[model samples]
Target: MIERFIELGQGYGDLYEMLEIMKTNQERIHNTFVFVSEKDGKKVASFAVAMKPVGDSKFMPIYICREGIPYNAEKTSQRYDLFKEGIEAANKILITLEVKHSSAYVETTLYYQYLIGLLRLYHYIPNLG
Candidate 1:
């Protein structure tokens, strides 16, 4: 399967769009993930949803809010709460992982590749054929 990460910014206005994507495609939901990583000494998280491939298509789109949420700071914890509640409502298992920051890689593409590798290694996603 061809899987890709589609970024939705730091989960502000874009967060709503991501939620709508998940809510509307409830049946196609595959997994929800919370990737926690330290950015400039601050703990931040990136939220994502992996959707199953439709029909004969092999593209599995992973929608995400890339690392910039707060428990109580510039952004409120309510945003994260909304995400948690949404996942709970869908009854899908939520997978949380501690990972290195994207800055570790020379390019964002490399970072995504590392994540996909981790996902496959953990059996969260199908192994490469």
Candidate 2:
């Protein structure tokens, strides 16, 4: 299976589009994720919607709004709140994980590969066939 992260810009106005994709394709929805990371000493989050592999292609696309919203236990950004509300409205529990910032890798592709491995290890997504 080819599982990939399709970045939809940072978590700004693009967040709404991500939510809309989930709402419209609820059936194909496999899991919802909120990846938290520390960048420049500030905690931020990336919201993602994982969709099941479609047909024989075995292309599983994980739509994401990369790290952009401030996230912490003390307080939350309005953007994060909207994402949380959408998850609740969809009756899906958010899977939160603390991870290294994408900038840690030389390439964005490497960063995504690291995320895919982590997801597979946790059984959030299937392993290689």
Candidate 3:
């Protein structure tokens, strides 16, 4: 399968869209993740969801709102709270991982590639089809 990350943008609006995607496609949700990283010394997060490939298809989409939200254990944003509540209602466990900032790579493409490698290694998704 051609597993790919569909960039959804970075903003409150974009975050709302991701939440809608999750709610609308609840059955297709294979897994959900919150990738936390430090950018310029401040903690940030990226929310992503992997949808099961459409019936007998070659494409597997992993939607992501890349590094858009602030991350802090002491507090949470309303946006993140909304996402968490929806995730809980859906009965899916959210996976949060600490990762290297995308800026660390020469290009954004490379950063996603590295993440894909990690996902496959952990068997969150199957090997390339």
1 against 3, candidate with superior TM-score? 3
TM-score per candidate: 0.92, 0.94, 0.94
lDDT tens string, model 3, 48-107?
998998898878899999998999968988877887887887789888889999999999
- Per-residue alpha-carbon lDDT of candidate 2 for residues 1-129, written as tens digits (9 for 90 to 100): 899899998846699999898888878888999999998899889999899877778899999999877788678888888888888878888999999999999999999999999999999998899
lDDT of 1: 0.85
- Each model's lDDT: 0.85, 0.89, 0.88
Query: Which pairs of residues collide in candidate 1?
Result: none
Query: For candidate 2, what is the lDDT?
Result: 0.89
> Candidate 1, 33: how far from true, in Å?
0.3
Candidate no. 2 TM-score: 0.94
Off by over 4 Å in 2: none
Which stretches of candidate 3 lie above 4 Å from their native place? none
Which residue pairs in candidate 2 have backbone atoms (N, alpha carbon, C) closer than 3 angstroms, thus clashing?
Answer: none
lDDT, candidate 1, 51-88, per-residue tens: 99999898888888988785333464877878878888
